[model samples]
Target: MSPFRKVPAYCRQSRTPIPFRQKQNEGLEALNTPLGAPRPGATRRKPAERAVARTIESDDADSLRAGRRRLGVVLKPAAQARSRNKLERLLEVGLEMMNEIGFDRMRVVDIAERAGCSTGAFYQRFADKEALLEALAQRFAEKAWTLLDTMLIPERFEGQPFAVVVRRMVVVMVRLASAHAVLLREVVRASLRDMRTWTYFSAMRDHMMARLFEVAGHYPEVTDKAAPGGPIELAVQIILSSLISRSLADQRIIAISDDDYAAELATLMIRYLVIDDAPWDAALSPTVD
Candidate 1:
């Protein structure tokens, strides 16, 4: 009676359609089969392709190792630079404290404070005030050696004129003294009163003179045959004695200009050592009484 109606078929079927279910089973079997297993259209990897893949993987590992090594090298300098910066900061603070408060008045606390660090940091960098002073002295020694190398080294003066070499050397010495006047003055004062300080200064002096002797003696112009003992000792004694004498005498004088002092000392030196055209060997050899 309703507008929408259901229809029923009363026809009898001879057998249930088992073939339809079998076909569905076959389709599911196909679905469960491994892909690219001798299939009609699927592709499979060849032995050569597998070998290529292994080679690529090996190359990738090697490239990664090379990259890490290069990165390590690049990072190494950054670490060193940071360490150097910290050391420089410590040295700068220590030097500043010494200049402002005087070495005797400078304390580990003050230096560390100035450097924005703990006193422990100062200890890590320097054992004590004396150690810092020694470090400063070593720096000066290296610089002095560099200057000496320019003028006195055999290779540098191989074909140079003796007069030119001597003039340049005197200038270098004066410049070094001027630049290090404060440190030198402090050392000189301490050396006059303290045996330990004197020994330290004497050791440094001897070391420098030994090098000078070696270089000067090597020069063709000042060979051992021409100058005997080594010009190094003679030069050191003359320079040191003159410097000490002038410094003492200046203390007695009210005020003497640097020019006047230098001229006086130079004149005395030339009179004593440069008067005669002495053989290079005689000039360099050990000093006489």
Candidate 2:
């Protein structure tokens, strides 16, 4: 989590990670989304119709090479059509229920009912209700990593002012929290009892700091590779902490919308960096660049 003077470069592999599985997928028809649902194509076709049919037949092979679903946190791996469909339905229903009624009150039976399945079917997929949460957390981490890969590229902010960069970064994080509000809140709650939950999201935090430092441009370049950290790095820590605190706690303390929150955070960081008449302060105001 410590900030470095030089821009940090993570290998492409580090940014987007999926669960590891050793065994390859069997060419189960249900696995082809065979049970998931069919695409729209009912009528007879032209000369290439035969070719297309051959391609459809090859989907099982494709599944062997690619299309295999990444089964995260499920105790029983599903490859058959009936079982795969049930597994998919359970996860969909469980996520919806978790979103609707907090995870604490969501029941396996309730999710099964909504998915038009029985409790036995749900049990066939997950060991317990908590397994559903771990699945969601795993999916959230996948999405979060992809989001960070796309969102935190400093190159995207090139030619923009550092102030604008800060505001954009704040806006992105606020919107991310909004989109995954339920998962994030649960992670925050669970993190108190088990700090492991925090580890999943911490990389995003560290990535954001590095991105901000890169976008800060040459205005306040850090020379000390060694750190109690540079002023800008420390300032970013405060800004990021403030945003996280707002997301999980003290919601009643502020009444502003996400837009206003971003504005305030960006303003806070800029002002802190650009304090008046400070002999040692590295001002990041618009006047600097």
Candidate 3:
């Protein structure tokens, strides 16, 4: 029997349903509506989505705003092209150094020299190397939000088979992970020592799951919504965990190309969503066959 019989009241389409992309504005709306509030305004979200939104409160919002500000904290005003160019060079050189050498061993003087700027110039922009990492996190977050908006709009998959849509979502995600490989790795390594880092990554992951949940709402065939144990959020976490593990793992260890990896993940998601009478314990079944 399918577990998705009753669409949650919150997810039911309004006469003029709000698109998920616009519903979530890179943390702009902040979802002030609590669960079960009247749907009179533009900021309404389903309770499940609100559950995720609740995690993003004053602290998370402050962190996001701080990141956006710090990204532009160059020595001179970012309005100047030269200062902007130098900032970009510094970020590029810093990442190159971290990949070539370890983050701990990467030095400010070396980074400035490689970026063709003075050490004084680097200091004027970023207080220290950790600040640079914060900037990188902000940059990765921006790239991720843009990609999610572009790829997951409900219109793109209107006529596609469910399976194809799942695969497209997985591919878009895998590419984002590949693009910000270093930043993700650093977040995991440094998160224990820095709550800010952990908060950034965690908040991003929750927002992603929440967005995907909206996309799933469009397809009535998703028959597992009412399953026990927060199944939808759990499934999303499982998929994201795989992406993160692969992003951080040694290529030699995982030994699979991103393309193949994404295909396998798409399969995992489809099976998870379409399974029959399976409790969360049996969700990870033997095979698609």
Candidate 4:
């Protein structure tokens, strides 16, 4: 009925006697000695003491394994501060080399040489040139997001006119783009060929879009059209694209000066996001003297 057989009591009990040995006899003799009385040689530790010693050994082994796990691949900042600094120097050297020779042409040995470290040291931090590039990209992304956070605060533009806010935003965006033009160019180029690079860009774009949406919500004109496909999203995409393209392009090819371009772009965006009654041509056209 139970679909199982019960074990006999004798079968469950261990009946085989342990073989006697010289070590066992010595241990027994040590236990038989009187407490606090000296023995002829080394006395055997008590079972409880032995167990505690084993537990301590086991705990130490476990702690070592955990430390190795934490320190794997990446250097620990606290325990390995010098290693972390070496890694950072490698990245810095790699970034400079990338800017000079482009990512594909850059080599790990060159980076190490420039950093005044060995190739072994480079491998100790990064697995390869691509790994170092990824670290550079991550560093750039963190800095760009930090700059975005400071510039895109809606409260900073509170009570200001839409044109004033757009002007400030465009100025900051253009300035940041110009400052990181070389690194951003490499990142954009890598994104076109590498899925990981593309994913990083996509995630950053999504975060920026979300922030832009939040800022757009402050204005009723922009908020009115803030559905799935919205003018706010389109405006953000166009503004960012324009800034990036301009930053990556030679300045000589552009007809307008940087200041004029920034001003016109800001006015164009403000007109699109606000000024509901103005016609498209009238809003975008230059005023006659």
- Best by lDDT, which number? 3
Compute each candidate's TM-score over C-alphas: 0.53, 0.58, 0.66, 0.64
Ranking by lDDT: 3, 4, 2, 1
Give one digit per residue, the lDDT tens place, for model 2 in 1-289: 6584444333376764332221123224336655546533545567699899888997687656533443334244455677778776887787788779888999877898999998997776567776666566666666656665675566775655555655666566666665666777777787788775566677666665565555554434333321337776776678666666766665677677766776676677667666321111112211100
- Please give, for residues 6-66, the per-residue lDDT of candidate 3 as tens digits: 3322335655655555555623545655576654456767898887777666446555442
Q: Report the CA-based lDDT of candidate 2 relative to the real structure.
A: 0.62
The parts of candidate 3 lying over 4 Å away from their true place are 1-68, 72-76, 223-229, 275-289
Please identify which of the two predictions, 1 or 4, would achieve the higher lDDT against the true structure: 4
lDDT for model 1: 0.54
Candidate 4 lDDT over residue span 5-75, tens digit each: 54323323686444445546767989999999888676899999999999888776566643232211343
Worst 10 residues of 3 by lDDT: 280-289
Model 1, 105-138: lDDT tens digits are 8787877887888887667666777656655555
Q: Candidate 2, TM-score vs. the true structure?
A: 0.58
RMSD of 2: 23.7
Summed backbone clashes in each candidate are 10, 0, 0, 0
Clashing pairs in 2: none
